[model samples]
Target: MGWLAAGDQYEVALIEGRVAARATSGRAAGRQLKSLPKALRDHPEVDRLRRFAEWLDRHAAACVAQTDLWMVSSLPVPTGLLARVWPDEAWQSALRDLAVVGDDPDEVGFLRDATEAGELRVVNLDGETVRLSPATVTLPHPVLLPDLDDLREFAAELGVVQKVEQIHRATWRKPADLADNATTVTEFSGGTYDSRFALAARATSLGYRVTGGYATCRVRDTGAIVEASVWIGEPYWDDEVTTGGLSWQDLDGRTLPLREVGPVAWSEGMRMAAALHAGRRVEEGKDT
Candidate 1:
C-alpha cells in the first residue's frame, strides 16, 4: 500500500526552456515521455476508436438473434439487409459457411459472401463459387437443404454449430379436423438425427419450447389450440436416443383425450416423431 501511494505533488517544470515533470517533495526524478505530443483525447481517431469498440461489443449477440429470427420464422431476408450488415465481422461469421437458398429453392449452397452489388456469393456442392442475384435469400430448414450430408460433413469439419434452428425446426402441414374419437400412435425413436441434441435443436429452432426433456410446440388444431410434446429422453448426446412417448396436452399439462386432440396436433406430433425417428435412422446409416 505504501508503494502504491503517491508521496508528493508533481509539477511540469520548464528546464532549459523544455517542459519536464518534476517531483515537488524530492528532486527532479521524472524521465521524459516518449514524445511530447498533443493530447489524443479530442482527436478524430479517438472518436473512431470509441465507435469501433462499441460496435464490437454489440455485434456478435445481435447477429445471433437476427439470424435466429430469420430462420425460425422462415422470414424472407432481403439481400439488402444481408449486404448492409455483411461488412461487420460478427454478421459475416454468422452468415458465412451456412447453406443459403435464394429465389430458386432447388439451388442451395454455402454462403461465402454478400457482395456490394447486393448479390450473394456461394459455394455449391461441386465446390464451385457462384454469384446469385435474387431479390431475397433464406437460410432454409435443414430438412429442406439439398445435399445435407455433405453440408453436415463440412460443418463438422469446420467445428461450427448452427446458432439458428434450420435443421431442427418442425415442418408444418395443412390442418384437418379429427374424427369424434380418433387416436394415433406416433413414434420418434428412429431418425437421421437420433441424438437428444439433434431432435431438441430442430424443435427449438422451429420455435418450439424445450424444457425438462420435453420439446413442446403449440399448434391450432381444428379451431382449437393445443400443445404437443415429444419425449427426448435426456440432455446428453448418446449414440442412440430411446425417447419417451409423444402426447398432446392442454395448457395445464393435462393429457388431452384422443377425441379432443385435433388433426393438426396429431399431424404435428407425428411429424416430430417421424422426423426424430428418421434422424435416428440416419445416424445408424439405415437411410444412407
Candidate 2:
C-alpha cells in the first residue's frame, strides 16, 4: 500500500500487517520507524492502515477456512477458479504446498504455482516439477490419499508448511468386522464437563456445530452426505453433563449401522468426539 500523508513531517503506511510511520523531512527521512510515532498513533491515516490490517487478517483466515473445507470434502476445484485466485496472497498462502490430484488420481503432487492460463506447476513424489492443465483438480482428504505417509515425508523434506491442514490431518478407517446392527461407538463417551455451556463452547471452538443436544459434523462420503454426531447435552441445561456415544445418521435422520458408515464419516465423527472428550476435566495426577 502507498504511504499516506499523516502529518507535515510524517507519513504512514501498513508494513507487514502493521501500521508504520516514517519521517518525511528529518534525519530519519525515508527510514521506517521502529514503532508508530506518538503523534501518528491516533492520526487518521494510521487508523485507516490499522483497520486495513485487521481486514487483511480476517480475509486471510477466511481463505484458509474455505480451502480447508474444499480439501475435507475432496471437491473438484476448477483450474480456472484456482488461476483467478492465485494472484491473491491470502488465497495463495492457503493453497500453497497442498497435495493435489489432477485427471489421473495416481499422479499426486504438491501444488507450487497456478499460471494465468489455467495451468498448474507441481512437484511430484518423484521430486520432479510438472505442469498440469486439467479442467479440474481434487485436493483429496488425507484419508483418501494412498501415499499419505510418503507425502508427509516429502513435505517435511521440502520444508512445506500448509496454512490449511491437509497432508497431516488426522484420519481413521472404518473397520470391516463391525456388527451389522451396531449404530454407535462408545469409545469417546463418559467425558464429563462442568456445564453444558462449557461443553458447547468446546464443540464450537473445534469447528463442530452444537445443535439441540449433539455436536455434529457433516461429511460427503461415497457419493452420499452423512452427519456424524455425538451427544453433548440439552442446550438449556445448566447442570453438569457427560458426552454420549458417537453415531452417524442419514439424510432422513435414521441412525446408520456401524458397518454402513463410510470411511470419511466415521473418521470425522470420531475426530469430533475425540476432540470434545480431550477437553474434559481430569482429576489431578490421575490417568486421563
Candidate 3:
C-alpha cells in the first residue's frame, strides 16, 4: 500500500494490491522491475500479479478449448450464451475475429463487435457490414467451410484480420467411423516450451497452420488427404508445460486408424510432432 525501499537502488510499492517497482535512479529508473531473484520477487504485490497472470493464461486456454469443442462437435452455440460472456475480456478476446454463421449458414462473416446490450455486428463475405439477431452462431473451422479462400480475400478487402487464427487454423478431417478405426501416429510426452507462441512459431516455420491451440497440416497420399494436428499448450504462462498428443483425422473430422493411414501421412505427421517435441524447453523463460 505504500512505497518501500527494498534496497538503495530500488523502490517498490503496492499499486492497487499488486506489487509495482522501479529503479530509484539510473537508466532504468521508473521502469518496471524484471529478472529479479525468487526471494525478491515474492513481494505481496508481485505475487498478486503472478496469480492474475496465471488466471489470464488459463482463461485463454479455456477459450480455445471451448471454441474447439464447438468446431469439433459442429454444435450451434446460443447467441445469448455468447452475449452473456461477450462482456468478459477473456471470452471476447477468444471469440473475436472468428467466422460466425447465423441461422442461414450461408450468411457467414467475421465477428467484429458485440455490445454489452447484446447487439452483434459482423462484416459479411460481400464486404458489407451487417447487423444480426440470430438465435445462435457457429464458428466453423476453415476446412469445414466452403469458399474459404474467397472469405479470406473478402476479409482482406475489408481490412479485417483474425486475431485468433481461425481462418487459417490447422484442422484435420474426421474419419467416417472414428472410434472403431482410430489410431495415433505418434505420442510424445515430456515436451516442454517456454510459451505457446514459441511453439506456434516453430510450427509455422515448418509450414503448419496454428489454430485452436494446435499445429496442423494436410497430407495427400494415394488420392486421399488427411489432416494431421498436434496440440500445443496455451499461449501464455512462462514455465515449461508438456504438449498434447498428436493425431490424424479424415475428412469428416473423425480420427483415423493408424493402420489405415498411408505411410506418407504417418511419416509427415510424426515429423511435425517430433519437430515440435524437440523444441520444448526445460525451464521457464520469456514468451518471445
Reference-based TM-score of each model: 0.46, 0.95, 0.53
| Number of backbone-clashing residue pairs for each candidate, in the order shown | 16, 0, 10
lDDT of each: 0.63, 0.91, 0.71
Candidate 2: stretches off by over 4 Å: none
On a 0 to 1 TM-score scale, where does candidate 3 land against the true structure?
A: 0.53
Q: Regarding lDDT, does 1 or 3 come out ahead?
A: 3
- For model 2 the local lDDT of residue 149 reads 90
**Candidate 3 stretches greater than 4 Å from native:** 1-40, 171-288
The top-ranked prediction according to TM-score is: 2
lDDT of 3: 0.71
lDDT string, candidate 3, 10-121, tens digits: 7676554355677778888878775553555766655666576677778877886677556543467888788888887778877877889888878898888886566678
Question: What lDDT score goes with residue 106 in model 3?
Answer: 85
